[model samples]
Target: MEITNDLNSTFSPYSTTNVNATAAPNCTDWPHVPMTTLIPAIYSVICVLGIVANALAVCVLAHSSASRRTVANTFMLNLCVSDLLFLLSLPLWAVYYSQGYNWPFGNIACKVCGALHNLNLYASIFFITSMSADRYLAIVHPLQSQSARDPKRARLTCILVWVLAFACSVPTFYLRSTQHVEALGVEACAIHYTSDTWFYTLTWLKIILAFLLPLLVISCCYGAIGRHLLAGTGLLRIHPSTNAPSFKSQESCCSKPEKPLTPQQCVNKGSSSSGGRGGGRQLEGRGLERVLWTVAAVVVSFFCCWFPFHCVTFIDLLHGGDPMASCWAQWTIKNLTPLTLCLGFSNSAINPVLYCFIGNHFRGRLGGLCKGLCACLKARGEDHSHQRGSFSTRLSSFSRKLSDLKDLAIAEPSGSA
Candidate 1:
């Protein structure tokens, strides 16, 4: 929403001959559009939808055993949190837009809301890039990944991401304020950069940090992952039985007549037998395939959603032209902007869905939970209603088991550490 204004202002310099005092500093003319009908409805719908979807995603990720402590899931959770915070400001925007850009809320609210909006932009990009980096490490440098895969390290990384995201957003607080226009009844809250130099500099910085850099990182990571997966799969086909002997020998050694082997010796023997030359490659390859596919889906979704919005904005900036000159084009672009932004926002909500659908273990556990819940409900409805206590007990037990499974899912693998 904030970016919409930015895009308009950026392109306004070349569009209008008359300046409307009611509009923000950079905007040339306030198009006399009645916000009462349009802006409120649009903002309200987006706010409600984004908040509900993101909240549900958070709940699912929190409750599902498959999403708990994983590095990828951790990033997703943080992304959802940021999205929720961003959504908090949307109602305020809706009210302002409904009032024809008048700010009933004070200067501080304006600044805070503006800052939060930008904060989400940077925070989302950072977490997405971090997720990509984690996958890259897991696939491309499996041995080295152990050092960075711990929960503590992952938590620290999230903190660092927040810090950087906040730093990037600081400019919004400084630049955003309510400006009163001479002849208009409305007041606009907008960024008032000291000069064109500062404005364009910040704009380009955002484009680079929040868009271009993340795009590049995701693309490269997924590309490497894809290549590695293909190579690994090819190798796996060539050595499908390479680890079979090791597994057989290990099982035999475990059940054979007693031998005086130390626990460490036994572990070493087991590792030696199971650590077939190609097994690591095959596992790494499969992991890479999963990571690449997920990242590819996310990256493609992001580009599809944001590209049109950014392209139109940048085009106007370059051409020094008026989008409004072409009424149909302006209307089309305006309609498309919200849709694109919505799609982009929906990315936060989709990660948990991807995890649930793509992960075999997660699907099985979720299925079990559903079955348990259904059974518990059915038992409670029986004529022997005194068995309600037993139904409760069963439900509690099932919940506990689900919680334990979730803990296991989030926990770092022993080998990873």
Candidate 2:
């Protein structure tokens, strides 16, 4: 969906100041506050937060060696890059909205900014789909999907995703241009399609590829994962006591014996056997839970952010620019559309927190990075201080030597007299 639409139209959330006067004469009462005030403000905030968070995520991920990076981390790193690029376009959008949808920047910038939105939409969803697939393979077909889960393959997949997303966005680049709107006499940036067929075709293509297909794949993957976890499959089960995955419980140290034992006996044996290992087991269990939580949060956040916007878009599509549409539909199209678009845009900012900072691994890495930076700064400060101190000492010693020479000359002259 085009989160930002042609502001010269009646349905657009950005047109407040008579920009649609000639085109939409019947439509009165534009939402000036939301379009010009709230949206730009929110977009600015999201832009700042997204750039910082995603940049940190990218730094942390990039710091990892290739061998240490996992398939999920590779996808996450690519997601951060996509978010960074997307967030970079938000300031221009904020300015555009604040100026009553006027486009002062030339045609090239208009196209680039508009295209980045689509690129981000397609790329982020595809990366998320890749992540869901990776999780599915990791949990459901761990032994069988080893080659597919390789970090190298994941990197290659990310490259392909970028290419595909850019390819999908090429149309937006071609169609977006700056034009002088006769109604408002201001230059506006919007997509100009030759026919309704082109518009409908692209709209359907976006709905199918970016939303529907990804939703289906992700839902199926997560559904199977839920079933697998709930079915109590012996192949991969969490230990009741430790909560750690028991991939080979039959061969585990706490495995049940062939002979039946009393509950007390089993308890005593488990305690004695797990004496020194209990701490490690507990840590492992927590790590596993963290991973699960991170994955679930990422998926949930994506849907929560984009679903409403997509729903509104679909509703607007059904309304189809009908002047006789219900007041509710018109209100939704005007008021809620901008809010939902901001919500969708905020997802890029939220993704870094969900996909990276929420995990213990990334948190630890970030902590290490911070500490390392602090240490470097401190050491440099100390080195500079030491150098200054030594320089002062040398200067003092030289002054003393010069004073001694002067005294010696004076004493020698007095002795000669």
Candidate 3:
């Protein structure tokens, strides 16, 4: 029977690095040692760090008070959850590749792991896109989006994303299985498609739904936000005196003033006309710069990590050549595939740093939470110390009373004698 399967490169079944004995003689020269060694090691590191970082993020977000909650924070919390779901499956993939594409885990394990992997791909991107949308609304349509940006609505949106992501992953859970490759004499955990149509359909779906669509949405949001900020900055730079009509209107209003201005009002007008606008603009510019930096970091990191993998997938789909027969295919499978896969996996690991740790507001909240925890711990410690001291005092007094009674009993015996 002709077989097609994949370990972790989307749902594509053709893997040049997989240990298949049917490859062409020249293609057989592809090095397996580096792939087996480095994939497991890098996967292990990513899994561990990703888990810890995301877990901490979950805890912090979960414990945050309602008053402190916002749409962005809610999306970030869900993003962390999505990364964690994917990170949970990394160790199994690590071991699978480490053992030369052999899957020790049974069929069910394979399905569960694959499903989790699928979940992360959709969930993470969706959550990120949602965050970008929330920011766009906040910066560009602050007053208009107030009702839409409520924390309750954000939580509901997160629930919808999770459900949608799970729905996307349902196919993976059902179709994934462990097949024993006769050529290699090992069971490999991968999706087995009975037909080419299903294989291509799913692969295209992953690329389009998970990567391209989100990228497009993110670009539109940030692009609009950037233009809005630039426009506002331009307005801030233009002095009121530069506009003849507005200056004339202000002069007319001043000419018919009903009451004499107070000293405080005069001082405020002087400051506003002189230095206040400049100072305000300077502050606004700094805030805008921070927002741009954050947006750039998120977009750049995302592209760097997932773009290569998607590019390879796209090219492979277009190439439509036999991996063992084509030199370009062989080179890609041996070289670009592993690097891109590693990059894609590392994205989950660094998300906490990129999304949450870099945000000044997030840092402030985290710091406040840490301080509160420390204070609570300190209070508990002090209470425990007081209880211990009181217990010791009571015990000492009881011991002394018992000794006195014994002494009195001995004296009574002696006197009776």
The predicted structure with the larger TM-score, 2 or 3, is 2
Q: Rank the candidates by TM-score, best first.
A: 2, 3, 1
* Residue runs of model 3 more than 4 Å from their true location after superposition: 1-22, 28-33, 232-285, 321-324, 410-417
The estimated TM-scores of all candidates read 0.64, 0.81, 0.79
Local accuracy of candidate 1 as per-residue lDDT tens digits, 73-127: 6776788889889887878877775675577988899888888877887898788
**Model 1 residue 255 CA deviation in Å:** 12
Task: Give a tens-digit lDDT track for model 2, residues 214-235.
Answer: 9889988877765655454512
Can you give the lDDT of residue 10 in candidate 3?
Answer: 23
Candidate with better lDDT, 1 vs 2? 2
Model 1 poorest 10 in a row by lDDT = 270-279
lDDT score of model 2? 0.69
Between 1 and 3, whose TM-score is larger?
A: 3
Candidate 1 Cα errors over 4 Å, as ranges: 1-42, 63-68, 182-184, 232-293, 316-343, 355-417
Residue 325 lDDT in model 2?
Answer: 66
**Top candidate (TM-score):** 2
Q: Provide the clashing-pair count of each candidate structure.
A: 2, 0, 0
